[model samples]
Every structure is written in structure tokens, then in C-alpha cells.
Target: MRLHHRLKEKVLESVSSVLPITVIVLILSITIAPLTPGALILFIFGAVLLILGMGFFTLGVDMSMIPMGEGIGVQMSKSKTILISLAVCLILGILITVAEPDLQVLANQVPAVPNPVLIFTVAAGVGIFLLLAEVRMLFQIPLSYTLVFFYAIIFLMAFCTPDSFVPVSFDSGGVTTGPVTVPFIMALGIGMASVRSDKNSNSDSFGLIALCSIGPVMAVLLLGIFYHPSETVYAPSEIAVIATTKDAAREFLTGIPHYAGEVTTALLPIILLFLVFQLLFRRFHRHQLLKIVSGLVYTYIGLILFLTGVNVGFMPAGQHIGAAIAQSPYKVLLIPIGMLIGYFIVKAEPAVLVLTKQVEEISNGSISQKSIEHSLSIGIALSVGIAMIRILTGISIMWFLIPGYLISLIMTFFVPQIFTGIAFDSGGVASGPMTATFLLPLAMGACEAVGGNILTDAFGIVAMVAMTPLCTIQLLGLSSRLKEHLPPRQPRAKEEVEDCILYFDAED
Candidate 1:
């Protein structure tokens, strides 16, 4: 009964998140970019699946992944040997990232690099940086200094990297930290920090994702420099033709097994790792173990449904709408339309829900999930608008990213440390499967319509989405800091004022 009630609450949250985007798409479909009846029906079904998948996913993460990650982190932190903890962090990071389904999609896109080579390269980068993140936390080092140093290196490499590969490198960073990795990584940070008695412990829990994001960016940048792939190709998603409701159902039906296999593959490592830990540590009781087993099942089902819904249902509709808008007389409406979609779209990102909830809990409600969601939404809105400008004008992405990172890194010095961590983490979480499947396709379709260089323009929308939240969420932190410093006024009593005046008069 308790489980039923929790599931109800989670589904309600998913409804609130997924409905806005659905409504926005519907409005666009009927008014400007009219979708076929079958396409419209598929999209609606996809939205329903998304809501259900998110509900199950969030519940499962709360039950299984969070506890498992936290348990492992606490056990490792309790170990006296630093080398052992570092080794464990590295191994876990590599294992989790290598199997990430989003990373696989990214690897397949760049033809110059062998898929295995790219996958392992990105995974190694994640493992190494995750090690470094742990080292920083162990030594109680400041996150700002670390961010500044690494970003300086990243920019230097970006300048040296081939023009076409720059966006790919940044996009690699965003995709590698997909839905599977974020929840575990964030929970691990919390567990690792829990052992510390220092004031900085809570703040330390966040920057792990931030730092992990850097690894893939740097790795891909280096790969680009080495490969110098002169002309990267962009393949627009093939929009499925749905003439009948049966065809739409057939599309979803075919997608289910494929996603099931992928989700199963994606989840196996975590499950195996958990079992090993359970055997070694016996950290959980029988009841806890049974609940976790149940949660894993929920997570499996959720991911399968979520992936199928997005890839089969949402992708075609997004591409169709984007192409329709770009081909219209009021083509420039793409900017505002993209911005509106961006505002609601991030809310539907599965990982964003996990990140925001964790932030609220870690901050002890000092920072609310609603505030984080709003910040992320505004950031994504701006990014999609900027991306549309690039699609129309064919400008280089560097113009935005360099200055954006500089500002974000500088703000790291000004804002509270916890905000810096959450901000960077938000950047990655905001660009999950929803952005990749829906927003990227939207950009691609628009880019195709405008006859723009899809490689240069459409490829970087994820990077842009990943970049903006750093500044916005940190702005939220800055506001929080200012509020702390500027306390509310309390009116002085008339008696006290009179007493003070009388004393002054006497003294005079």
C-alpha cells in the first residue's frame, strides 16, 4: 500500500513534467506545423509512456540505485587505504560509462574513430577524472580552483582541436553522463561525503558529476586533434511514416524488444556490482535486499518503455515539426518556438528529476527542486534560442562556449561551492535522452531546412544545452548567498528610539 502511494506521487510528478512539452507540441502541430493524424496519435502515446516510464524510473532509482551507490561509497570511505578507494572509484566509473546507451549512440556517429576505441577512450577519461574528483574530496580541496585549472586546459585543447570536431567533443561530454550514470554517481558522492564531519562535506557531494563531465570533453578533444577528421557527416533521423494507428502501434511494439535488450545490457553491470558488494559487505538486510530487487525490475521496465517512447514516438514528431516550421514563411519563429519547447523539455529529462530531488535533499530543503527546475528551464530556453540562431546564420559554436565557460568558471569563485557543483551537474543532466532524441532531431530538421552545415550547427545543440545551466544555477546560488547576507529588516520599537534619543540628548 505504501509502495502504491509512492508510485502515485511519482506518476503525478511525471505528469506535471511531461504534459507541458506534449501540449507545446500539440499547439505547434495544429497551428503552424500540422502533423499527420497517425503521427499525432503516436506522439500522444509516447507522452503517456514517458510519464509512466519516468514514474517507474524515479521510484526504482530511489529504491535500488541510490541505496546501492550510497552503500558502496560509505564502505569504501570507511577503508583506511586511500589507494583501495581510488581504485574502486576508477573501476566503477569505467564500468558504468562504457555501457551507457547514449555513449554508444555518440560513438556510432563519429565514423573516423572505431566504436570500441571511442567508447573505451571516453570511458577511460571518465574513470581518470572520477579518480581525480575523489582525490579532491579526500584532501578537502576547493572545487573552484579545480574547475578553473581543468577548463583552462580544455579551452586550450579546443583551440587546437579541428573546427568540426570541437562541437563533437563537447557533445561527447554531455552524452557520456546519460541517464544510467547520473543517479549512481550522484548517490555515490552523497555516500562518500556522509563519512566526513567537515562543513564542506555536503558541498563536496555535487562536483563529482561536474568533474566527470570534463573527462569525456578532454578525451574527445584529444581524439579529434589526433584524427583530424576533415569532414564529419550528419545523418538526419529517418522519420517513420505512420498511416494508421496499427502502424503506430507496430512501431512501438518493434521498439520495445530492442530497447529491452539495450536497457538490460545497460543495467547488468550495476546489478552485478551490487550483488558483489552485498556478498562482501552484507550491508543490507533481507527486507532491504528484496526491495532493491523489486526496484531493479521497475527500473528495467521503466527504461525500456522510456527509450521506446522517445526513439519511436517523439523523434519523428520532433523532426517533422522542426522541418515544417523552418520551411514555413515565418521561419524565424523557430527561435521562439524552440525556446518554448526547451523550457518545458528539460523538465521531462529523467535524470533531471533525480538530480533535482537529490539537490533538495542534500541541501536539507534550503534549495528547492522547483528553483533548480526553473533555472535549468531558463538556461535551456536560452540555449535553444542561441542554437536556432546558429542554425540560421551558420556561426561557429566557439563564440558562445568560450565566453560561457569563462563566465561560469568565474562565477564559481563568486557563488557558494554547492551551487557550482549542482550547476555543472545540471548542465549534464539537462541533456539526457529527451534532448538527444527530441531536441537534437529538432535542430537537425531545422538545419536541413535552412541548408545549413548540419555538422557544425545541429551537432552542438546538446553542448549548448549542457553549457547554459552552469551559469543559471550558479546565479541561483548567488541569489541564495545574497539573501543570506542581507537579512530582513525588523522595525525598531518607538520606546527604544525614544530611550536612545533621551540618552543622546542627556549626553549632549
Candidate 2:
């Protein structure tokens, strides 16, 4: 019954995400130009796959990844051996990040840099930050101070790195933590906090994502110093038309098994680790273990189907549309259009709604889901606008990132601690699979048309999407704090006497 309810909730959230994007596409097609029948069909198919993928991914996290990560966190914390915990965190961080699909996609888009080298460097960054976050939580270190120091290091590295690699470096920070990483990392926080009797256990649970994000930025910045962009041209490709629904469906169906294999490869290591731990710890019963294992299977199947549809049917259309629009006399409209797409795309982000709901529940409704969604939407809108400007003008991403970080760092000191943590975390969550699969390619298309540097101009949409949310969410936090600190109203004399009589009666 619990499993059934969770599945239902996952489906509803996925639908909410996919529906807005579908509506936006429909509006765009009707107003701008009629979409090719093939493109229209592909869009619908992509939406279905995206929602299903989100559902399965969420379920998988709940069943296998979350529990396993949390268990490891608790056990590691109890050891009270700093060296062992640090070693475990570093190794796990690198391994898990290396398998992240979003990061892999982003790496492939970066020109001149070797994919393997980029991947490894980003993974190492995550590992280092994961260790730092764990230590911060265990020792009750303030999140703001660490953020200030680490961001200072990042800014210094930005100056040392080449111009071409700058955007990619910040982008790596955004893409490194997505659907695959969030659930496991959040669960890990819960586990780590379980062992600490401090009043700030919940507070400590909030900043792991913030720290994890820093790892990729710093890693890629260092890489930027070593790597330079080559004079490479990216010519946009024309997508062939699919004549029939059966063709599209058949193509999607056939690729499912392949994706199944891929997701299995991605998930197997974590599953094996969980099983080994379960055997040693014997924490959960046979039935509980079986249920979790079943959930993992559901997640695997869903993800395979989802990825197959997006890559095969949707990506080409997104790129083509962006190129088509950029060549139009109304090319400037791309900014607003991009913002519209971004506003809805975030709704389609699989991990985002999950994070929002969790925040709402954890805060006991002090922070509402609607408020979080609004703040995130505004942030994403600004991000998309900024990305379009970059594509148009070839603006250096560092100019934006340096100021963005400075503002986010300063805000961290003023906002409630939990909001600061969540805001930083939201930066990463807001730019998940949807941004990678669609918006990045859209920017790439625009950059290609304008003869801009793809590495410098087109690459940082994900990072911008990630960065804006930090400021917006903290603003919401500041507002909440203001409300909390407001003085109570004075009672009228009659009302005060009535309250005094009621209090006396209660005491008697």
C-alpha cells in the first residue's frame, strides 16, 4: 500500500512537470509556426518518456539508493574515525559522479577537451566536496564560512583558466548533481544526521548538495587552466522525417532494451554495495529487502524507456528549432521564447519537484511548495534570458559567475540557515535532465548560427540555470525570516481581560 501510494505520487508529480512543457510547446507551435507532424509526435513521445523516467527514477531512489546511502552514512558516522569517513566519501563521490548521465552529456558537448579527462576531473571534484560536506555536518561547521572560502578559491581559479574553458567549468558544477545524485546524497545526509545528537542535525542535512556543486566547478576550473579550445566548427544537422506513428513507436520500443542495459550498468554497483551491507548489517527484513529490490527494477525499466525516447526522438528537433528561430528576422524573440521554455522545462525537471516537496514536508509547511515553485520559475526565467544573451553576444560566463557567486555567498549570511542550504542545493536541482537534453542544445544551435564559440557562449546555460536559483530561494528565505521576526500584535483591554480569566480557569 505504501509502495502504491508512492508510485501514485511520483506519477502525479511527473505529470505536473511534463504537462507545462507540453503546453508551452503547443503555444509556440501555434503562434510561431506549425510544427512538422514528425516533430509534434516526437514532442509528445518525449514528454511521456520524460514523465515515466522521472517516476521510475524517483521510485528507484526511494527503494534502493536512499536507504543504502543513508545506511552507509550512519555506519560511517558511528565509526568516529575521520580518516575512514573521508576516504569512503571521496571514493563514493567520484564513482557515483562518474556515472551521472547529465555530466556525461555536458562533457561530450565541450570541444577540444578529451571526454574521459573532463569526466574524471569532475568526478574528483565531487569526491573532494563530498568529504568536505561530511566534515562540515559532523563538526557542525557553519555553511556560510565554508562557502565563502571555497568560492574564493573558485574565483581565483577562474582567473587562471582560459576564457574558452570558463563556462564549461561552471557548467560542470551544475550538471554533476542531477536525478541520479540527489536522492542518494539527500539520503546520505539523513543517515549522517541520524548519528549526531546535535540540535542542528536537520540543518546539517541541507548543505551537502551545495558542497557537492562546488567540487565540479573547482575541478573543471583547474582543468580549464590545462585545456584550450581548438578552432572547431559545429554545423547543425537536419533531422529526417519519420512517416508513421508505428515507425516512431517501433524505434522507441527497440531501443528500450539497450537503455535497460545502460541503466542496469549504471545502477549495478550501488545495488551490489547495498546487498553486501544488508548481509553484514541485517538491518532490514527479507520482505523489506525484496520490496526495495523490486523498486530498483521498476526504476531501471522506466529510465531505459525514458532515455531512449528523448535521445532518439526529441534532441534533433530541439536543436533544429533553435537554429530555425535564430535565422529568423525575429531572432531576438529567442530570449523570451527561451525563457518560456526554461520556465516550463524546470517544471519537467525530475528531481526538482521531489526536492520541493521534501522541503515543504521537512519544514512542516513553513515553506510552501507554491512559494518554492514560484521562486524557482523566476530564477530559471532569468537564467534562460541570460543564456540567450550569451548566445547572441558571446559574453564571457566568468563575468556573470563571479558576481553571481559573490551575491549568493553574501546572501547566505543573511538568510535562515536551512533556506541557504536549500537555495544552494536548488541551484543544481533546477538544471537537471530537461535542461541538458533540450535547452543546452537549443543554445548550441543559436551559437552555431551566430558563429560564436560554442565552448564559451553556448555551454553555460546549465550553470546559469543552476546559479539563479541560489539567489531566488534565499530571497524567499529572507522573506520568511522577516515574517518570523515581526512583533506580535497587542491585545485590546477587553480581550486581554477575557484571556486572563481563561488562563486563570485553566490553571485552576
Evaluated with lDDT, which candidate comes out highest? 1
- Name the candidate that leads on TM-score: 1
Which ten residues in a row are the worst by lDDT in model 1? 228-237
Residue 247, model 2: lDDT of 69
* Residue-level error in angstroms, candidate 1, position 119: 1.1
Model 2 pairs whose backbones collide: none
lDDT of 1 by residue, 1-508 (tens): 6998998999999999999999999999989999988879889989989999999999999998899989988888898999998998898889999889899887778777788988998999999999999999999899999999999999999989989889988998899888899999999999999999899999999988888999999998998888767666756667677888898899899989989988888889888888888898899999999999989888888888898899888988988898899999999999999999999999999999999999999999999999999999999999999999999999899999999999999999999999999999898899899988999999999899888888998999999999999999999999989998997999899999999999999999
- Cα RMSD to native, each candidate? 4.0, 5.3
Off by over 4 Å in 1: 492-508
* lDDT (10s digit) by residue, model 2, range 1-508: 6877888888787888788877877776676635677777877887788778878777776677677777888987887578988898898788788888777777666657778988999999999999999889877899999999998998888888776667777888888887777877877887888787777776777888889999999988877676665532333445657788986787677768867766666677567667776787687788878878887787776677667766665676677667767877888988998988888778777678667876886678878988998899999999999999988987788778778879999999999888988898899888777777778778887778777777678877888999999999999999988988999897679988999999999999
| Candidate 1, lDDT over the whole model | 0.91
